[model samples]
Target: MEPNPDREPGIPTDLLGVARIAGQSLRHIVGAVTKGAVHTATDLVDDIRSGEPISQIFDERVDLFRRAALSALGLTSTETGVPVETKVDAEDLKAMGDAMITEGWDSAQQPRELHPSFVPILHDLTPDEARILRFLAVAGPQPAIDIRTKAPFGIGSQRLADGINMIAAMAGCALPDRDHHYLGNLSRLGLVRFSTEPVADFRRYAFLEAQPPAQAAYRSVKMRAISSYRSIYLTVFGKQFCDACFVLGDYTGGGWAGDDRGDIYLGKGPRLP
Candidate 1:
C-alpha cells in the first residue's frame, strides 16, 4: 500500500489536522500578502505600486487560496471541489442573504461552532447520508432537491430529493416544517450555512467547521484500516510492500508469484525433487 504520506513521520496525520494546518497557513499567507510582508514577486510589485500592502491582490483572496488548494489536491472538479464562478448572480446572492437572515434569527443569535467530533455526523453516515454531507460540505446550505441533484455519487436525480430527507431522518435531525428545515438542522449542528439562491435551481451551502471529535474518529478509523490492511498483506507476503507493489508488482518483479518465491527464498532457495 502507498505509505500514506498523511500518516508519515512529523506530518499532520489526521484529515482535520491537515485542514487546520492548511487553514492556518492560508490565513497567514493572506495576511502576509495583504500587509506586503511577504516578498513574493506578485506581492512585491503590487506593494511597490500601491505604497502599501495590496488588499485586492490574488494571493490575499480566500477564493484564490481555496482554488489553489483544490487544484493542488486534484479535487477541483470532483464533488469535493469548490465551484468555479465567473460572476455572482444577483438572485443567488439575494438568496444567500435571505438564508443568512433566516439562520441568524432561528438560532437565537448563537453562531454555531463546528468541532472535529462532528465528523462522525458525516463519517458514520450511510452512503446516502454521506452523499448529503459531501454535497453540503462542498456546496453549503442547499435545498434538498438541489443537494440530491448535485451529489457527486451519481445518485439518480429522481432519488436525490428523497435521499436527503432519509439522511436527515437517519441523522436524528429535527426537520423544520418550513422550506429550510433540513438546512436548519444542519445549521444547528454547525455543519453548513445557506449562502445563495437558485439562479437555475442553485442553492449554496457554505462549510463552516468540521466537528473535532468526528474528524478524530475518522482519522482513527482510517489509520486502523490502513494499518490492518498493511498487516494482512505483510502476513500473507511475509514482507511489506507499497500499494504500487501490490498492484503493479514489486521492483523485483515479485508479486503473488514473487511472494511465493520470497517464501521459498526465505525458507530455502530451491529443492531437488
Candidate 2:
C-alpha cells in the first residue's frame, strides 16, 4: 500500500503487526513444503534424474514457494488493491537462488517495520476513531452534539458516540453507556476532562496531557496522572497537535481578537459604581 503523505513522519506501528502475521505464515509454508517432500523425495529425485517429471517438480516447487512467500508477506488469498500474483517462474527462482548464493539470507534478522502504511498514530484506530480523538483534542470538553458538529466528517451525534465506543473497545476500556459514562471513561483515561460548567448546552471536554513531557518533572506529573492513557494519540495527531494546543494555542486562534487585532477583553475598563 502507498504511504499517506498527510500522515506524520515515522513508520507506522501497524506494519509490524502485519509483518508478524506474515512471519507466522512463512513458518507454516516451510513446514508444509518439508512434509510434502518427505515421502516422495526418492521418487522425485529418480523422476528428475530420468527427466520425466521435470514440469511436475517445477510446478509443485513454484506453488510451494509462492504460497510461502504470500504467507510470509501477510497477503490475503484475494488481492485487495495491489496485484499479489506469485512470481514463481523458473527464471525468477534461479535468479533468487543466485542472489542468495552471493548475499546470503540473514536468518537472525527480523523485520523491524511492522507499522501500518497509514498514519502511525492512527494505526490502531479507524478513521472515525481518529477523527473523534482529533475533535476532542481541539474542541475541549463537549457534549456529543457539539462534538459531532466539530468533527471533520460532520459525523452525526449517534455516529460520533459509536466511534467513541469503538475507540474505548479498541483500547480495552469499558464501553460507556451514557453521556456521563463517556465523559467518565475519557476522564479516567486522561484523554479528556470536563469543565466546571457546560458550554453551549453541551458539556465541555479538553484534551489533557495528550503528549507526555520530556523533562523529569513533566514525566513524573504525567506518569502520575496520564500513564494509563494509550500512546495511540501520538500516532494519530502526532506531536504538532499537542504542541500547538498546549504551548502555542494555535488551534484556538491563540486568543487573538478578529475585530481589534488584540486579545478579547471581557472586563469593563472603568465602571461607575
Candidate 3:
C-alpha cells in the first residue's frame, strides 16, 4: 500500500519484461479505479440537485469511487450493493483442491517467476511492520529476551514477559507500543522468524536484560529471574521483500545489529510481570 524508496538503486534494464507484466496488472487496477465514469457523473448531478453541500457532495463522490475501485479489484466482497460472504467452506476447499490438481496437470500453462501472494502480502502488512522490515534489512538480527522466574532445576519457571526487544524504537515506528503485535503479524506472514538461539554477540543481551521489564521481572522474583536469550531475523522471503521494497541504510553483511542501537531504549519495554 505504501512504498519506501529512500535508496536510489537504478531500475535495471533487464527488468523490462518484469515491468511489462506489472503494467498488465496495473492496467486492470487503473480500469477499476475509473469504472463507471459516466454513471458517477450522473450520480453527481443528482447529489447537486438534492441541494447537498458542494464539499459533502465532492467527498461522497470520492468515497464512492474508492469503494467501487476496491470492490472491482476483488479486494472487497461488496458487489451489487450486497456484501458476499468470504468464509471458505467445504465446497470451496474441494473446488480449490481440484483446481490445484487441474492447474498442475496443465502442461500448456507457464509458471510465473514472481509469486502471486506478494501483492496480497504487501496489503496485509501495516506501516509499522514495513518499517520493521527496513530496519531488519540493514540492522541485521536484533536481540530479544524472555523474562521468567528462576526455579530449581529449570522446573516450573513462570514466564513474566516474552519476545521483548527495541525494534519499534529503532525502526521509528509511529505506533511503538504495538511492536510485539506487529512482530507477531510479521511472523504470521512468514516474513520474519523468532529464533530461540541468541545472536552470536552475547553483549547485546546485556543491554536488553537491563530494560525495565527484565529488571522488574528480576525484582519481582527477588533477583530470581532467568533471562532466556533469543533473537529476531528476517526469513528468506522477508529479505527478498525488503530488498525489493525498502531502503537499507548503512547495511553491511548480516551480523551484529548493536551498532545502530540507541541508548534511550533501556526502560521502554511495553511488557511487565
Cα-based RMSD of the predictions, in order? 24.8, 19.2, 14.8
Model 3 lDDT on a 0 to 1 scale: 0.63
- Compared with the true structure, model 1 gives a TM-score of 0.17
TM for every model, in the order presented, reads 0.17, 0.22, 0.60
Expressed as tens digits, the lDDT of each residue in 87-200 for candidate 2 is 355554554345333322434222233322223333334433433444445443332211121333433312111112122332233332333454443344444543333233
The prediction achieving the highest lDDT against the true structure is 3
- TM-score of candidate 3 on Cα atoms, chains taken together: 0.60
Judge candidate 1 against the unseen true structure and give its global Cα lDDT, from 0 to 1: 0.30
Q: Which ten residues in a row have the lowest lDDT in candidate 1?
A: 225-234
As a whole number from 0 to 100, the lDDT of residue 204 in candidate 1 is: 12
Sort all candidates by TM-score, best to worst: 3, 2, 1
Off by over 4 Å in 3: 1-80, 86-92, 104-113, 249-273
Flag regions of model 1 displaced more than 4 Å: 1-20, 24-28, 31-36, 41-129, 134-166, 169-185, 188-273
CA displacement after TM-score superposition, residue 36 of candidate 3 (Å): 29
Clashes of each: 24, 19, 0
Query: In candidate 3, how many Å is residue 79 off?
Result: 8.2
